[model samples]
Target: MIFAIETAALQTFDGAFADELFLVARILFGGVIAFIGLNHFLNLEEMAGYAEYKGAPAPTLSVGASGVVLVLGGLAVALGAFPTLAAGALAGFLVVATPMMHDFWAVPEDQRQDELNSFLKNVGLLGMTVLLLAVSTVEWPYAVGVGLV
Candidate 1:
């Protein structure tokens, strides 16, 4: 497996080195999630306005609720707590939000590229979330699960 190969190749370093690397990766990833999620709160009014412009019903409430998900999911992911659920929640959030918020096809030519890029970035994040779901072995904190921090 690719992991096996990488681990074997990196055997020159202490095993803890690899663990620390992964830990850092998770922490950084989680930090990013937390940042964006927290941003939603910091710009609640503007975000809600934009959501309203996008035709999201009850934009204020929607933004508030989604922000909560992002913060919680990001925290859980960062801590490797219930990772599958956390990552899955993140993936699901991105999937629904990306299309609704980044409809590049609906934008003008000038804005299309930017929107498209946002959409693509969300896709990449979604892929990472799914990958986390697939590869993580930490157990669920509140229920049966698998994955390690």
Candidate 2:
């Protein structure tokens, strides 16, 4: 009985630490995503030009709309509000944009490496969003408690 109690106490301590770490992860991860979104606005002309070059219809509008989605979704993830939706939105954006924007195979040889790197990075972000989705249904410790499932 005493051993069991001691084990439980240790588990509680470890769980608290892990929970705090999760919060940190959310902050850093979401912050990067939000910053990327902001960059879309900051470099609007350049980004839109690239999008146009890639044959995106209404390139400027597409970039602006994506920027809004990224900023909102990233902020929600960071704030732990509407976690499932936020993660889902982020995942969806990645799924659509990664392939459309970073078609490394179709790019010229000179640009292929850069595009490949960008593609790989987006893939990594997508994986993280999926991970968040997997956990978003659960109550996150220290969350703002505004989640829908």
- Score candidate 2 by TM-score against the native: 0.88
All candidates' lDDT scores? 0.78, 0.89
Task: Please give, for residues 3-109, the per-residue lDDT of candidate 1 as tens digits.
Answer: 54343322222465655676677778878888889999999999999999878889999898889888988887778777877888898899889999999999889
Q: What is the C-alpha RMSD of each candidate to the true structure, in Å?
A: 6.0, 6.5
lDDT for 50 (candidate 1) = 92
How does candidate 2 score on lDDT? Answer: 0.89
Model 2 / residue 41 / CA error / Å: 0.9
Model 2 lDDT tens row, 1-149: 45543432122214548888988989989999999999999999999999998888899999998999899988888889999999999999999999999999998999999999999999999999998887887787678999777
Query: Which regions of candidate 2 deviate over 4 angstroms?
Result: 1-16
RMSD of 1: 6.0
